[model samples]
Target: MRAVVFAYHNVGVRCIQVLLARGVDIALVVTHQDNPAETIWFDSVAALCAEHGIAVTTPEDPASAELDQQVRAIAPDFIFSFYYRHMLPVGLLAHARVGAFNMHGSLLPKYRGRVPINWAVLHGEQVTGATLHEMLAKPDAGAIIAQTSVPILPDDTAFQVFGKVVVAAEQTLWNVLPEMLAGRIPRLPNDLSKGSYFGGRKAEDGRIDWQQPAQAIYNLHRAVAPPYPGAFTVLGATTYVIGAARMARRTFADLPAGLAVVDNSIFGVGNDGQAIAIRTLTANGNTVTPEQLQQALIDNPH
Candidate 1:
């Protein structure tokens, strides 16, 4: 099948690989340029396209008239979007004579918006998956073609969960491509009423709230750690970023909600009277050892 692919990130790279392996003629690839301010940790769809000699474009606006003409010129049989940041306009979708499909990070009818993996981890979801669905005017509100689910361990970070979703996206597309190629497309119901939609998250969303339960606080940390923004909290006029944390196994008497240091381990006592062991902490972009945190606590005592 001849196709125009709008893709980005590792999921985009792998999904495109699947299409190529299936002998699809990728007439064009639409991708985004890596933002200098953001961390570029995943495989690049542009690089993959270059290796295969496919034409690629990094347009600031996917809906521009020029882009519309470009896509129309290709006259692709199908259109596929995988992890592409921007929404493809209906005008672009019309260029696909066969169909326009999208591979989403979460199961259809659940977590159906931006950064699905991170939202799932933030909400402490037990499971999340990838779904390949028909593209509609409304984002992620389309008929499901196939899906592949993965488990979310209690302590799994957003990055770890994203790795699983990438594989799931690849598998979901691989398993369903043959049926689509044979002109037998499946249209499973995507009950939007049964699921929730979430907007994109920001760095400020990582601010930890001490009044929350320990597990909730830990979930926040896991949801935005490292490659994503680390969860933070202000203490005594200083902002501390929590790089790693886990629910405290033991109890401590008379400890109130907030930062605490006992022996040499740093802890964040939640309003629920529970605590989380802060395994890695940082201040002003510098790592703060437990000893340093203890000394700070001693000097401040606030």
Candidate 2:
């Protein structure tokens, strides 16, 4: 069956490749333009479309009528969205003869909004998954077609969990494609009351609060660690990007909360009296040791 794909990034690229390999006719590809300033870890959807000689469009407003007309002209039997940034309008969703579906990074009914991976990590969820669901006007508030779980290890960062999500997404799609093409895919309605929604995060949101528990601070560190924005804490005038930390086995409540040199290692005291040993850190945009960081703070007191 012919399909119109609204996709982007690594997951999008993989989904498109799978469709093409299965002999599905890709009528058109709709994706986002890559930002040169942003850190990109995946193949661009536009680039992938170009390599296959397929028509591709990068429209900022997926809900616009201009995009609606474009997809309507294609008259696709199915519209598939994989990691597509914007919410598809009802107009566009209705244009497809069969149905429109999207692959969400988190299990449906939870972590439904933007940056699902980061949210899942921040909340200390042990198991998050990919959900294939019927596309709706609201963001990720869709009926589930199928889902596959991915484990979130205590040590896993957002980027690491993202890798697992990519695999789960692909596997979920592969398992449900045949039913989708046959218009027999099951739809399980979600209880909106039971689900939680999180908005998009910003670089400023990565600021760490030392008053939190060591595990919570560690969660914040991994949630926003590189590929997203690294979690940070200000020491003097310099903002230190915290990449990795561990919950110290011993409590150091006598020490004040926040950055401090303890036994030649950098540790952040938390509200729980436990310490988070800073394992990886950056200061002045350069990787620095605990001693070096403390020296920088000593040299530049604001």
- Name model 2 segments beyond 4 Å from true: 296-302
Could you say which candidate leads in TM-score?
1
Q: Which one is best on lDDT?
A: 1
Clashing pairs in 1: none
lDDT of 2: 0.87
Task: TM-score each candidate.
Answer: 0.97, 0.95
Clashes of each: 0, 0
Residues 49-165, candidate 2, lDDT per residue (tens digit)? Answer: 889999998888888788888888889999999999888888889988988999999988998899999999999999999998988888888789999999999989999999999
lDDT of 1 by residue, 155-202 (tens): 999999999999999999999999998899999999999999999999
Worst lDDT run of 10 residues, candidate 1, spans 250-259
